[model samples]
Every structure is written in C-alpha cells, then in structure tokens.
Target: MVEPPMAEKDTATMKPVGTTDPVGITVVVPSYNQGRFIDETLRSLLDQDYPNLEILVMDGGSTDDTVERLRAYGDRIQWVSEKDDGQTDAIAKGFARATKPWITWLNSDDVQCDRALWRVAETVAADPAVEVVVGGAHYMDADGSNPRPYPTIDVGPGADVRREVFEKGYMAQPSIFFRRDLYERVGGLDRALNFCMDYDLWARFAASGARFGKVDADISGNRWYETTKTAGQTLDLYAEILATQHRIFGAVSPYFVQAVSDHLYGRFHSKFYGDRGHLFFRWLYFKALWTVINARAPWYCVKGLFCQTIAKSGPIAGDRMTFKDWRDGFKAFLRHGREVRP
Candidate 1:
C-alpha cells in the first residue's frame, strides 16, 4: 500500500494522544474551520463505549477556535493542526498514521449518532466477511425545519452495488465504516476529486467485490450549514457522479443502463429532479425510458412525466414530495420485479 501522502508539510507538533486501549477501530476526522461543531463531533467519538477505539483528527490549519476547543479534550485524542493540501489530503495523512484494522473518517461538522460506533463495531464483529458497514443518517440543517431520516440503499446479498450507488443515491458518509484492507486495496479516497470523492471510492470498492452490510439504523447526524462543502457544487456533484462511474464502468456499460432505469423509476416514484440537471441527464433518462418501454416492464417514461406534471401542479418544480408520498410511489415502481433486497 502506498503511504497516504501529505500534500504539504509544515512544522506542527502532533497532539499527545493519551495511552490507548488496544485500539481496534481508528476514525480519522478531517476538519477545517468547524469550531462551532467540532466539540460536539469529538464528544460523540469520545463518548462511544467501544473500548478499543482511537480518534485521529487531521485539521487543515483551522483559523477558528477548533484547535483551542479540541485542547480541552487533553490527550484523549491524537491530533495535528497543520497546513495540508485540503480535506482529502488531511484525511490521507491521518489514514496513513492509523494503526487500527478497521477505519472510518468523519468530517468536523458531522456528529456520530447515539452509540453509532458501538453499533458499527458490533455489526463488523459479528460478521467479519462484511467489509463495509453502512447505516442511515439524520440530515440536519439549521435553516431547514428539522432533521429527517435519509434512507440508504440496502447493500447485502444479491444487491447490485453499481445501480444502488450510482442511481439510488443517498449514501450517508458519516454512517459508513470499512476494513483497512479494503481501504488499502482501493488506495483510499482519490485526491484529485473535490466533489463526489466518496462516491468514486465507493464505486471502486464495489467493483472490487467488497462485501457490504446495512445496519438499518440511523448512525450519523450530518449538519448542512450554509458553509458546508455540500451546499455549493451542485453542478459539480451531478457531473462528477456520472463521470466517475463512466470512467470505471465505461460509457456504454449495461450498468449505466440500469442506472438510467433506476433514475426513471425514481422519476415516476417521486425521485426525479425536474429540469435541474445537465442535458446528459435528460438524454440518459430517455434511453432508460426506452429500455423499460421495450421490455414491457410496466414502467414507462410517460408515468414519470405524469408524476412530474402532478408535482408541478401544486407546489412547483424541483420540490420533493413528502417521504411518505415518495415511499408510496417507490413501492409501485418496485412492483415490476425490480425490487432490491437488503
């Protein structure tokens, strides 16, 4: 495995991590200017009852009180505040230093759900074959009303990793953990990608045939404040998702056909984004619609058009239906022998 490179190096003393208790899981937190929430994030990690857990935080030279705030934790956490390349670089640096067999990373603004690490550890302990463990998450935004359950695709026996990841959407970053071997095999997160880096990594791991487990529980509290990395980059997010998948799966792979099929199903099932994506999205939608149409799969482009029409009638375009409405529609879409299993 290549040493996770540090894009830049500076003279910054590493935090004096207190004596660890035979660490089994190491979570590398990559943070920058997230002082408002970093304390809570650290608390969630420290408060985990899982004894053999270690916290390695990599800060990209936070100008805020992030360092001062973390200082209160004393030697409890192993940390370094320095000038690094970026979030991905900081993560790579921390990952290289991690000695735990199982590893995960949490951004500074995110908080681990109640007993999240414990649940992850429990699941992985029970089934060593399950290389990646993922759970649902509570997406919270201060401006938005309240936190809501962001459903994750069920990845397990007989699951299609490509379709679920590339098409189904909604994989919680904070709620995921994988073995170190998988990390080393895939070469960790790609430093070149600013957006969709996690998606790219997941795609490669899936292609590598890594086993997956869904915890079926909410394991992360992901904040979506104004300054969050996700807030901007809407265009880049959409473009990179397809580009990364294409780079690996090829432009004409049948997997992409399934992706379009899945997207169309979502369109009818209240999952489509109306007139808000790149032109290629429309082209893909048409092709996928043709596939379902020719197969007589009881799913058609017209149905989604009708649904979109209804959506635009009352509220407006681009507004999502309530979770209940979307779930109801999805059940109908799954009726045509396309249901995915957990």
Candidate 2:
C-alpha cells in the first residue's frame, strides 16, 4: 500500500522557546447533557496549574443543566453552548478556535489527572521535535471510583507508530496531547466516523511520520459505565475500527481480526452457554475451531489463539495478561471443564 506524505513542521506557527519556558496547550472538551460530570471535568483542567493553558468547552446545545454549569465557569473557560452536529463536530469547532500550539480533547465525562498538563508540557518542551505526546489513563467506574490502569503500550525508541496503532490500537484519546500544526497537517479528525474518530486521527498521525513522546504516568480518568457510548455500542465500535484499519492499511491486521473474533465468541457464549455451566468450554472450543476455519489465515488464527490464550497479546484495549496468569487460568478451566475468568 502507498504511504501518506511525511509531516513537516509549520515554520509560520512554530515559535522558538527556552527549555524552562512553558508550552501553551489547548484542551477541547466536547459535551452534551453531561451536567452531572462536566463540572468535575472542567475542574480537573482548571486545577492543572499549567502556566500556559486554554480550555474550550463545546456544548452541543444540551437541554439539561449543562448550559448552567458552563455558565458557572464564567471567564475561567472559553465555551459556546449551541446546536452542533455531534461530538466530532463540536471538537472540530473548538480546534478551529484554538490559539495554543499544542492541543488535545477530553470528553465531558472524563477528567484529567492531577498535574497531567505539566507532564505533557514538559515532554514537549524538552524535545521540540516531538509532535505527539501519549500518556497513560485509568478506567473509572460510573461513580468515578475504583480507578484501574488502562493498558497503554509504550511506543519505544525506533518503534513504528503506524504499525503499532494499526495492529494493536494502543492509544487512549483522553491521554493524548499533540501539536495543533501536526493535527492540521494530518487533516485532523474524520467527520464521518462517529465512534473511532480518535483512532483514525492517530493512524493518520502515525502515517504522516510524526514523532511521538511518552509520558509514563496516568494523564486522565476515562469513566466507564453501561450508558457510555463505548460500553453500549461495542460491536459498532469494532466495526468502525476495522473499517479504519482497511482505509489506512488497505488490509486488516490479523490482531484486529482476532480481537473481533474473540468479541464474537464472547457474545455467542453469553447467549448460548452463559447460564449452562456444563456447555461453556464446548462452545468455546467449537467457536475457536470455526474461527480458525473461516479466518483469512488459518495458521495465523490458530497461532493468535494460542498466543492470546498464553501471552495475552490480542488487543490493547483491555487489561494485559501474562503467560503465567493465562497458564494458571487455563489449568483451572481444564480441571473444571468450565470457563475461567481472569
């Protein structure tokens, strides 16, 4: 497949700075009817204490108390509460109005970690060539409690960002900070995608040969609940992600296919053998065999199943598991002839 053009620095927008100088960052927050959570989200950024920062809230004309909450912020944040197409549209509007050199977006339901902005700024300021800064995040429950580390793989030195993003999908939207010029250069977020716009943007950023830096700390808290878009529309999300893979690489990655297959198996198992404890492993084995037969590469699929079962290297969206953990779980599953939970 033909590769996209390389990213070039925008000299007109690039400003020289000292090592000690703070880098300006624009954070775009897209919201709709998230009155209960938006306040905390706004407060997280406001409390960052980063010397140079801009917080813009783009509300998609929420009918709830969201507008009142935005008004409560007063001049602390730049906001526009009006009708917009959707979350992607609101983010586009906010990005268009951004004056800072570095930019990122946080959903109204999510909150940035303490001093997260400082970590991002310091990384960017230390290396002027770094166009993207990727940090870690935590999965918070609906009540914003029990925060667990979100699996964020470090794109190490000389690692291919495009390959990692395309194959493993290893970045979190809330934990990402990138340069405004680099974003504009990569053509920004795709308007057509309702679910995987951030993933598509990362793929484009990687394809453009943009340099990336890692912040080895949790930068944001991504709240997870049944009502959330990600939790509710998981199948649709995977469909969008697969479509994005095809669009970027002209072929779907086997790792992504394995992830899709695993998701399908889980749904099937839940529907057919969820309550029937005896038939769990039987259905799993049957599904595995069927998946191998239908997969584009049968051997690759079999190997993936083994590695996923052992090394736990299928997808980065979920918590990673080690070989020893998987081996112990497998032993228990075999001994009881039932499904095992890790």
Candidate 3:
C-alpha cells in the first residue's frame, strides 16, 4: 500500500501501512455549522480499528466554531473550509482528493462504529467485483444512549440487487462504503438535492448493474437531533424521496405506484379524520407498510400498519413504532378491509 499522506503531522506513534497493499480507504466528513458535534464525529473516525486510512473533513464555509474545532484536530484529519454548493458537492471534492480506492461519508453529526472500516475492507477484499458494501445503522442520542435501529434492507444472497432494496432503500448512505471507481462512474451525489441525494445515488448505482455486498453488523450511528434537517422538513423530504424514485426508476416504477397509494390512504385518513401530528404518523406507518408489502414477500406489511394503529387508537406523542404493533394492525386492517375507519 502506498501509504496515503497523513492528515496531521504527528503520526510517529500511529501504525502506518507499508507501501504494498492494493487498496486504501478514505473516510470523508462533510460538515456545515456543526461546531458542537464535529469533535465527537472526528473522534469516532480517528478511533477506528482499521489501519491504512485517511480522514478528510470538508466544510462548507462555516461561520461558527466549526472551523476552530477543525483546527483543534490538527494533523489527525485533513480539513478544508470553503464555500460549496452543499454536502454532496463537498463529498465529491473530498472523494476526488482521496488517495484511497475505497471511501465512505460520515456526516458531521454521525458516528461510525469501531469496526466499520474493518468490516467494509473485509467485504471489499473478499469480493473483487463488489462495487459497494453496506452494513446496518441505528439512530442514537448525542451521548451515545437511546438507540433506535434503522430498518434493515434485505438484499438477499449474491452480488445482485433485489427489487426490494430499491423499493425500501436497502442501503443507508452513512453505513456503506463505495469503490472509488464506481462512485465516479455513477457521477457521485447530486449537488442539486439537499435531501434524497443518497437515494438518488443509490438508485443510479443499482441501475448500473454493479455488484453489492452486505456486512451484517451495524457500522454506523445517525443522531436524530432537532437541528437535523429531517426534523424540520419531513414532508419536503418525503416529496423529494418520491420524486427521486420516479426519476431514477422511471415514473411507472412499482415503487412509485406503491408510494402513491400509501400516501393517498394516509393523507386522507390523517388530514381529514385526525389531528395534524396523526396525519404525518399515518403517512409513515402506511409508507413503511407499503415498503414491506411491496417487497414481494409474505408477512412484510407489518411495519406499515404498526404505527397507524397507535395513531388510530388516539393521538401520537412521538415518532416510534414496533413490529408487534404493526403485525396486529396489519391483521386488523385485512380483517375489516375498507369497512374500518382510518
């Protein structure tokens, strides 16, 4: 491995890979004004168990302590502060400068598992044809407590992608590593999209007929704080996601049709028959259910029905759902069919 250049000057004590390996990996952290959380984010990357790694922190001209915090990290990370379009563009610039053949992005507020790079490297090493390796991820609080695992996408055995992955978003961007060549081949992320760039990129990659691999272990943690974009723009994000799917998979993709039906059902029930919060809750429930049902597998409609049942029973307090509740709701819906009230 031609040991990639170190981000910081003090690498005398750190283990360095000899210049003999065929592949090097880089982890890019695309940040904005995340001064309070960027330190923890970079720490997680620096603590990774994998050897022969590069850490690149690219910021979009932060006017806060984000730059000062980056400076504090010194040589541990290679960082740059300048204006850019957004996260996607920053990531592309980082990837272009990376000396590694494999890369993954770590959002400024997200943390990587201790074994993330190790697992991704192992997957890539095992399969020369694999263009992407995705693992599981969970959402956690800032202090690393209160974990809620993201839904898993079952891509099944083999190098090919199943329709279910695309339908249900099989690969979480933060939890996956990509081959540099494949990333470039797909034209990287869409700078135009503030949200759903991950979905768009994943769709493009899947459409290319590239090979994919799965690392069964959870390799990343996403934080769900109020400052996160998803918190403020749920409906907007949903619309972007729907639109992205239509554009990438074609307007008539089964996934689009399923989304439309689920959206209609939930929108009607929640907006007309229930409170505003309940409306959004129902939309998520039905969407998750739609994903499961459309997976073309039996017993997958549970996720969709799980949340809707709670909202139907009363008001929604927060965003949370369980499989058992969904299963029960699914059964109830099937039994009553259209006769049941929303």
Candidate 4:
C-alpha cells in the first residue's frame, strides 16, 4: 500500500497544554477531493476543549489541493494523502493505526458540533460498559444555514437492537462514538460495501452482543449536499441497506419490506416508477411490497412504521403542510421525478 510521510506531532494543537487526562479519543478523517469542507471539518475537531485527542487524516490522494489544504494546518493534524482503496478502505486503514480507546471516523465533507468531543468523552467516561454511543444530528447545507434536527432512535443497553436496526434503519454514523475493542470484536468495517457499511458494522456489533448507549444531544453536523455519497448513490444505498438487512435476518422479512415501502424515499421511488413503470413492472413493484407487508410485517413490524420510516411533518415543507398539498406532492413526486438520496 502506498503511504504519505507523516509530520511531527503538533502537541500544542491536539492536546490540552500538559493537563493530565485520559487518552480519551481518536478520530480518523478520510478524504478525496473534499478540500472545500475539509477546513470546516478540521476546525470542528480542533476547536474542541477536550484534554486528550489524536486525530489522523487519511486521504485517498485527490487531484485537487486537498494535501496542500491539509498542510496549512501545520502539524495540528497527522495526515497522509496517497492513492488508496475506496472510503471504507481508507477508514479501515485509519482504524488499524489508531491507538486511542474510543474511535470514530468522520467524512471530510462533514463537521462536528461545538465541543462534541467533550460530550462524547463524558458519556464514555461515565459508563465504560457502553461500547457504542449515538447522539443526535442536524442537516445543514453547504453554506451552513437552515439547521434542522434529525430524529434518531432512542435505544439502550437491553433493547432489541438487531431487530430495530434491521427494520427501522436509524443508526446515524456521524453522531456515533465506539470503543476500539468493540471494533476489533466485530472485525471493523466491510471494505467491500460502498454504502451502508456503517449499518453493516453496527448490525455485526449487535450480533456480537455489544451494548449501545444514547446521548440526548446533537454531537455533529452532517452536511447535506448533492455530491455526498448517499445523495449520488441512492439506488446503491438501497441495495446495500437491504443486503445488510438480509444478512442479519437470514431472509428479507415483511417488516423490512414494509419499512422500505412506507419510507418517504421509497414512496417517491414508487411514484417515480408509477410515471414510467410498464404495466407488469408496476404490478410487480406494488405486489412485492404488498406481499411482504401482509405476509410477514403488517401485524408485527408496521405498528412502529410511522415512528421512524415516515417523517411526521411530511417530506416537503414538513410542517405547515395541508392534506391536499400532501396528496399533490405524492402524485407530482412521480410526475416530476425529483431525485432522492436516502
């Protein structure tokens, strides 16, 4: 594997000026052609007041100025810009090099909330048994305006995480913090998965009997953009999510099918099909959804369908929406065929 040379560790920027504290956390950022958001992403981490932190940046060598931009940090960050495998591979490489007990990987285009590390550290410090910590998240534009709270599932140590994750699919990666031991136990990420790799890892962790914890506050900012992986690879993401679901359940459950059908994105996809779907194809699509929901999930899994699968406020202008507008959007969504990224 090709590797870029490292710089002398910049103790002044990463640590708390000689304050004695635990080697609490390490964050790995993997990037390629993400120079625009890279600065904000680094600043979010550097601005944290936590005592001990070691951040590593693994770049999949961009043709852009990503390396030069990172060098501007002047050793505050330890980074290597070189051509390597895909995003998951870069992150898995980062995991191999990280030494801190707590580990999490942030995308180059994303940033954390103010002092996000402090909150995460406290949660982990309080409960050593908590292998994974999940906090809330927000969706902001590239310009960083119009912040909105993203509702996530509230799960605890004893919850049925495997079932919920398979059915609801609410585990957000940005706001999650996990221990190093757990990562090793679950065998880290599956590099083969382009999308939904985090979900796959989480399912494996649950399957390995790892307990989860929840933080009741927003810990990071997940920037929403047209170019982000999830946005550009919606169809692939759906397939990966289903693949993960099937891997855990041994078969695609009705609950899972219903979960997909009742989703806003799936609904839009359904409409997208309705506009262009051949008669037989349309029949197959609805029949597949209906067959699964009625056979395996209608009575059992869909009771909580409205809980996470569908947004309560509706997808467009979530609040202040009328039934007629909802009706029209549902119909027009198919006619106009707006692009949906998970």
Instruction: Please tell me which predicted candidate would have the highest lDDT against the true structure.
Output: 2
Evaluated against the true structure, the overall lDDT of model 3 is 0.69
Itemize residue pairs with steric clashes in candidate 4.
none
| Model 2 TM-score, 2 decimals | 0.78
lDDT of 1 at 134: 87
TM-score for each prediction? 0.69, 0.78, 0.72, 0.74
lDDT of 3 by residue, 13-88 (tens): 4544443343568989999998988988888777764567899999999998999988887777899999998888
lDDT of each: 0.67, 0.76, 0.69, 0.70
For model 3, the stretches where C-alpha displacement exceeds 4 angstroms are: 1-22, 159-162, 252-272, 275-342
Q: Best TM-score goes to which candidate?
A: 2
Compose the digit string of candidate 2's lDDT tens values, residues 1-342.
Answer: 111112232356332232354678899999999999999999998885555789999999999999998988788899998999898999999999999999999999999985788788668766878999999989999889999988775576888788888767767789999999999988888888889899889988888889999988888999999999978998898789877876776556655665665577567664664533223333344346436443655665566556543114444445555545545655655765544445
Worst lDDT window (10 residues) for model 4? 1-10
Report the C-alpha lDDT of model 4 over 1-342, residue by residue, as the tens digit: 111112222465553333325446889999999888899999999886455677899999888888989999887879988888899999999989998899999999888884677767656656767888888889888888888887575576567876666546565688888999889887789999998889888878777877788877888888888988888876678678777766675544434443354453345655665533222232234345545534444544354333322233332212332345446555655554555533
What is the RMSD of candidate 4? 8.9
Off by over 4 Å in 1: 1-23, 143-145, 252-342
